[model samples]
Target: MAQPTTSILCTDLGFEWPDGRPVLSGFHLAVGPGRTGLVGLNGAGKSTLLRLIAGELTPASGAVRIAGELAYLPQDLTVASDQRVDETLGIRAKREALHAIESGDVDERHFAALGDDWDVEERARATLDRLGLTGLHLDRTTGELSGGQAVLLHLAALLLRRPDVLLLDEPTNNLDAQARARLYDAVAAFPGVLLLVSHDRELLERVDQIADLRDGEVTWYGGNFSAYRAALAAEQESAERLVRNAEADVKRQKRDLVEATQRLAKSAAYGKARSVRRNDPKALADKLQGKGEETAGRLRGMHTERLNEAKERLAVAEEAVRDDAEIRIDLPRTAVPAGRSVLQLERVRLAYGGVVDLELRGPERVALIGRNGSGKTTLLRTVAGELAPAEGMITTPVPMRYLPQRLDVLDDEATVFRNVKAYAPAATDNDVRARLARFLFRGARADQQAGTLSGGERFRATLAALLLADPPPQLLLLDEPTNNLDLASVRQLTQALAGYRGTLVVASHDYPFLREIGITRWLEWDGGELHAVDPR
Candidate 1:
C-alpha cells in the first residue's frame, strides 16, 4: 500500500506502564495533513499515543517527529476557577501589555509583550464567538463557566496559538450536542495536521481517515467512521471465509491421512497373504514383507506431514479473524410492569432554577438532552434523590440507582467484586461472581482494583453495581453514560440497557446512543423546564 507523506511521524515508538506492562512496542505511524481519527478499544493506547505525540510523556524508545508547531487538547481539561477567560484563551498577557502601552506607560517590556498583536482581544472574541461562546466575557473567571464552556474556551486558547498540528483526545467528552456541533465546526475549520482520538461517532465522521490502533500497531482506513466500519466488515467477512476454507482443507487432509493409513494397512496385509500363498522361499517372502512395511511407513509419514501443514494453514487463517465479544445479561428482577408508577415530581423547583413537574411510568426509556448547563445533570441528580428540590415534592416509589459520569459509585481501592458486593450485601460471593462475569469481569478481572480499570471497565463496574443493588433499582438514572467511553463500551452499555426492564432516564449528548438504546421519549431541558419533544 502507498503511504501518505509524513507530517506527524512516530517511529518505533514504545511505552510501558509503571508496573512494566508494555503498551506500544516498535510501533510506527505517519500521518499527513487532514484530520485522522485515532480509534481503538479502551486499552489499545489511543490516549497514550496522543500523549506521546503531544510531548506530555517521553517514549521509552523511538521518536516522535512533528513537522511544525503542535497543540493538544487533552481529555480532562483542567482550568483553575480563578483563571480569567482571557487567560484561558491565552491572551491575558497580551491584553495587559496593550492596555499598559495605551495608558501612556512606556515600558519596553509591554511593547515587546504586545508584539504587534494589537488585535489580540478582537481575535480572542472572534474565536470564542465562532465556538458558540459569544456571551463569555474575557474578564469573567472560569468559575462562572460550565464544564462544556470551559472545554470550548480551552480549544479557543489552542486556536489562538495557531498551531501547525492539532491533537484532541476525547475533546467532546464534556460537551453537549450544541457544544459538540460547534467543536465539530472548529475541527473542520482547522487547516492543519489534525489527529483526534475519540469515540464520538459524530466527531469521528468529520475525519478524513481512521487510524485503527490494535495490538501495538496501526492500520489505516480511508474515510470516516461509517466507512471504516464497512471496510472492517468486509475484512472480517474475508477473514471468516478464509478460516472456513482452511478448516475444510484441514478436514480433507485429516480424512486423506486416515484413508491412506487404512489403505496401507490393507495392502500390507494383502502382500503378506500373497507372499504366503506364492512363497518360493521363506527368506525371500520375509524380505518382501519387510520391504512392504518400509514403503507403508514412508506413506504414513507423508500423509502425516500433509495433515500437519494443513493444520498450520488453518491456524494462520484463524489468526486473521477478530474476536469482538458483546456483553450479554438478563435483568429479570429489574422489570417494572406496565402501568407501574416509578416516579413523580410535583412543581419541583431545582436549586439551579428549573421547575420540573414530571411523572415516569414502567419501562420508559427517556432521553434527557439539552445544551450544557441547561440542568440535564442537575435534573437527573434530583430524580435520583442525590439532591433535594428547593420547592416541591419528589417521589420515587421503587428503589432507584444513579450512575453519574464520574462513575463514583465504586470505591477506587476496592475490587470490582467487592464493589458490587457492597451494593448487594445480601447476595453471596458466588452470586456476585456469577453476575460480574456477565459484565465481562470474570475471575481475576473481578479482583482488580477499580482505580486501575480502563474507562470501559470502570463504566461496566459502576453499571454492574447500580443494577445489582439490593433492590435491583426499578428506576435507573444515568448522566452522560457514553462520555469518554470507547465505541465497544458504548455498544455494551446499550446491550445492558436493552435488558433493563425499568424506567430509564439517560442524560447524554450522544444522540446515536440514545437512538440505539430505543429511547421511547425525548425530553429537552430549556427555559428552566422540561418539555416533551417529538421522538423524531
Candidate 2:
C-alpha cells in the first residue's frame, strides 16, 4: 500500500521552561501517516515537544503546521467528576440537538448543531465498546470508573473525534493487560499521523518507526522498538571501537613526542659539545647554542601540536560513546538464609476479601500478576504488615518493607537525605549519601526536597530509602514498580533488583521487567484466589 502523506510539520521549534531551562531549541520534525513511537530518557522533553505540537503550549519560536484536525491524550488525564460519557466523547451537544429535533422542535439551530453527524451517539458507543468500555451508559459519570477505565474512556473520546493526527503521551501508564491490549488494537487500526510518546515496550513494538528524542534533537530509526534497539546497539559498538582506536592513536602520538624530544635534546647537547671541542670564542659558542635551542624548541612545538590534535580526536570519539549508567550496589545484610522461611500466609483473607495461602522460603523472587483492582496491591500491603488480614494468620520472620505504587513512603517536606535518615536513624550522613549516590542521587540532588524531584528522581529516592532503611528489609514488596517510569529508569530498577539478595514479591504488569529480575515463581490472582501459573 502507498504510504500516507505527512500531516504534521515543526520548523525551527524552540521552547524552554519558565525558569529558563532549555528544552527544544531550533528543533525540527515532520511526521507522516502511520505510527511513530517517541522514546528517550526521563526529562528529555518528549512530553514537552508533544505539548508544543498539540498547541497546549506555544513554542518560544517556530512554526507548527498541521494539515488536518488533531487530538492529544496527555499522560495525566483528568475529567470533571460529573462529566457524562457522551460529553467526554464530545458528542453530547449533537445528541441533545438531535433529541430536540426528534421531539417536533424542528429548529434550524438544532440542525446546524447536528450538522451531518446524525448517528453521533451510535458512533460514540461503538468507539467505547471497541476500547473495552462495553455496556457503559452515555449518561454515566466519570467518577464511577477506575483509573484504567478512565484512560480508555479518554482514548475513546479521541477516537470518536476521528482526528487526522493523534498524539498519545504515556497512554498505557495506568492500563492493565486487558486494557492495554484494547489500546494496542485501537492504535493498530488508526489511519492517521500518529505520534506516541511512551515507555511501554509492547506499545512501542507495534509502531511503524521509532523517533528517538535526545539532547534537544530527534533521530528517526526505521522499524519498531526491537529494530531500533538493534540499530542502537550496533552504533554504540562502533562508537566504542572508534574511541578505543582514538585512545591508541593518542598514546602513540604521546610516545612519539617523547622520543622526538629526547632526540632533539641529544642533538642539541651533541652540537654544543662539538662547538666546545672546536675551541670557539665564548660569544660565538653562545650564539651557536642559542640557535640550537631555537631549532629544538620549534621541533618540540611541532610534535606537541600533533599530540594535542590526537587528544582532540580522542575527545570527540569519546563524546560519541554513550554513558548509560547502571545501578550497582551490594546489600549482603539483606540476604536471607537458604532454609529460612521468609513469609507465611495461612488462609489469609485480605481487607479486600481475597484469600491467599503461601509460604516463601529462602530468597525467592515472586511475580504477582493480575488485572486492575484484582487485589494485588492489597496483598502486597498485607504482606508488608501495613494492613491486617481480615481472617487467618500472617507471619514474616524478617524485616519487611513495602514500596507502594504511589511512592508516598517519603515525606514531601523533607529532603531525600532526611527521609532516608528518618528510615535509617543509626546511619550516618556520609553513609546515607554514599547509598543515595548508588540510586543516582549524588551530592546536591540528595539534599533536594522530595516534593521538588521529578517522577523518576522521586522513585529513585524512595527506592534508596527502602533499601537503606534500618535493619535492612529482607522481604521487599513492590507494587506496580514500573508504572510511569521511563525506559532508562526501568532499566535502572531492574539492575538494582539484580543486586538485591533478599526475598522479593513484586506486583507488576511489566512482563519483561519481571523476567529481567529473575522471578522464580509466577502467581496470578483471579476471583479472589491466588494460584501459581506459568509466566511463559
Question: Which candidate number maximizes TM-score?
Answer: 1
> Which residue pairs show backbone clashes in model 2?
none
Cα-lDDT of candidate 1: 0.88
Residue-level lDDT tens digits of model 2 in 1-536: 97446588999999986645578899999998899999987667888888899999899999998878899998767767899888888888999999999999998999999999998888888898888889889988876565678889989989888899999988887678898999999999998889998888889999999999888888899999999999999999999999999899899989999999899889988988998899999999999889888988898898889889989988999988879677888888899998699999999998868788899987999999887656677788788878888999998989999998778888988988999999999988898999999988888778888865656777888999999889999999998788667888999999888888899998888888899999999999873988899977
| TM-score of structure candidate 1 | 0.92
What does candidate 1's lDDT look like per residue over 1-536, in tens digits? 97434389999999986646588999999989999999988768888889899999899999999988899998767779999998877788999999998899999999999998999988998999999998888999987566688789999999999999999988998697778889999999998899998998888999999999998889999999999999999999999999999899889999998999899889988888887788648888888888988998898899899889989988988888887667898899999999899999999998878798999999898999888877787788787778888999998899998998777778988888999999999999999999999998888889888876767778889999999889899999998888778988899899998889998998887888899999999999983988889856
Query: lDDT value for candidate 2?
Result: 0.87
> Candidate 1: misplaced stretches above 4 Å?
1-6, 279-286
Per-prediction TM-score to the true structure, in the order listed: 0.92, 0.86
**Reference-based TM-score, model 2:** 0.86
